[model samples]
Target: MNPIDPQLPPGDPLVMLGLLASAILFAVGIVGFLSRRNMITMFLCTELMFQGAGLAMISYGRQHMDLSGQVFVIFILTVAAAEAALALGLVVLLYRRKETLSAEAWKELAES
Candidate 1:
C-alpha cells in the first residue's frame, strides 16, 4: 500500500514513468549531440546521455535489490569526470588558438 515503495512490478506506473523519463533524456542528449556545433554543448549532451544511463542502472539495481548497479554508477561517474576534464582542456586550448568553440575549428588541427 506504500506508494513510494519500489517493490512495484515491471508494470508499475512509477517504474514506467522512470523508464519514460530516462528514454526522453537519452533521446534529447542524442539530438543535442547531433544538432549542436559547439564543442562544449556537445560534450554536455554526452554527459546527459551518461546521466540517463546511470539513472536506468540505478533503477534496475534497486528493483533487484542489488548494489552492483550503484557500484557501476561510481565507475560511470569517474569516467565522466575524466572525460569532462580532458574535453574541457581541449576546448580551452582550441578556443585560445581559434577564438571560437565551434566543432569546425578542429579541422584546422587536423590540417596541420
Candidate 2:
C-alpha cells in the first residue's frame, strides 16, 4: 500500500502554515547570521537556515503528495549533519589560533 495519500491541492491549510513557518524560520536565521559577530553564533544561525529549507521541502512534498521532497529533506539533513561537524572543528581550530571567536578577527589572517 502506498503510504502517502494523494491529496489534491487547491490549498492545504496545513501546508500554508508550514510554508509560513519555514519562511519565518529562514528570515530569522538570516537576520541572526547577519547581526551576530561571534563565529559560533553565526554557525547556529546557518544551521537554523538549513532547517528552514528542510521544513519548506517537507511542506512542499506534503502539498504535492510526492516523496521527492521528503527525499530531498533526507539529503538536506545529511548535509546539515556533515556541515555541523565540520563547522565545529573549524571553529575550534580557528578559536585556538586567534584566541577569539569574533568574525572580524578573520581580517587579520588575510593580511598574513
Candidate 3:
C-alpha cells in the first residue's frame, strides 16, 4: 500500500506498526529516565523520547498526506540541539562540583 495515499483505509497495518514502534521508543525512554540516576543517561533518555515523538508525528503526517510533520521535526531537532548544549554545560558544572554524574549528588546543591 502506498504510504502517502491521503486516504489510508481504517486499520492500516503499516500505520499501526509505525505507531507501535513509536510507543515502544517512548516507553523505553520513560523507563530509562526513571530508572537511571546518571545525568547523562537521563539526558539520553530524554532525547529518545523526543525521537519517539518525532516518529509519531511523521507517521501521522504521512497518513494524512501533510508536510506539517516535517516542519515540526525540524523544530524538534533545533530544540534537541539547544537542549544538548545546555545539558553539556550543566553536566560540566555538576561534575566539577562533585566529580560525579549521579543525580543524587544534586541534593547538596539544593541544600546549600
Candidate 4:
C-alpha cells in the first residue's frame, strides 16, 4: 500500500503556505539586489534568493514524499557557500584598490 494517499492533492494548505513564503522571499531578494548599491548587500540578496529556493525545494519534496528536493538543497548549500567565499574575496580586493564597498567604485577602476 502507498504511504501517501493518492487521493490527496498537492495543493494542500501546508504546501500552499510554503510556496507563498518562498515567492515572497524571492521577491524581497530581487528588490534588495536591485535597490542596493553596496557589493556586500547585493551578494547577500543573492543568498536570500538561494534560501528561498532551498525552502521551496524542501517543501515540494515533502509534498511528494521524495528525497530529490532535499538532495538538491544540499547542492544549493554548497553553491551558496562557494558564492559567499568568492564574494568576500572580491569585496576585499575591491576595498583594497578603491577603499569602498559601493559597486560604483568598480566603474572608476575601468575608467582609470
Which candidate's lDDT is highest?
2
Model 3 poorest ten-residue lDDT run: 2-11
TM-score of each: 0.81, 0.86, 0.85, 0.84
Can you write out model 1's per-residue Cα lDDT over 1-112, one digit (the tens) per residue?
Answer: 8576678545555556666777888899999999999999999999999988888777777667799989999999999999999999989998998899999867756846
| Residue 89 lDDT in candidate 1 | 98
For candidate 3, write residues 2-112 as lDDT tens digits: 576758656667777877888999999999999999999999999999989888888888888799987899999999999999998999998998999999977766856
Residue pairs that clash (backbone atoms under 3 angstroms), model 2: none
Q: Which candidate is the best by TM-score?
A: 2
> For all the candidates, what are their Cα RMSDs to the real structure?
6.1, 7.1, 5.5, 5.9
Model 2, position 112, has a per-residue lDDT of 68
**Candidate 3: segments with Cα more than 4 A from true spot:** 1-10, 109-112
State model 4's lDDT: 0.89
The candidate, 1 or 4, that scores higher on TM-score is 4
lDDT of 2 by residue, 8-108 (tens): 54668889898999999999999999999999999999989988998899999999999999999999889989998999899999999989999999886
| Best-to-worst TM-score order | 2, 3, 4, 1
lDDT of each: 0.86, 0.91, 0.90, 0.89
Quick one: how many clashes does candidate 3 have?
Answer: 0
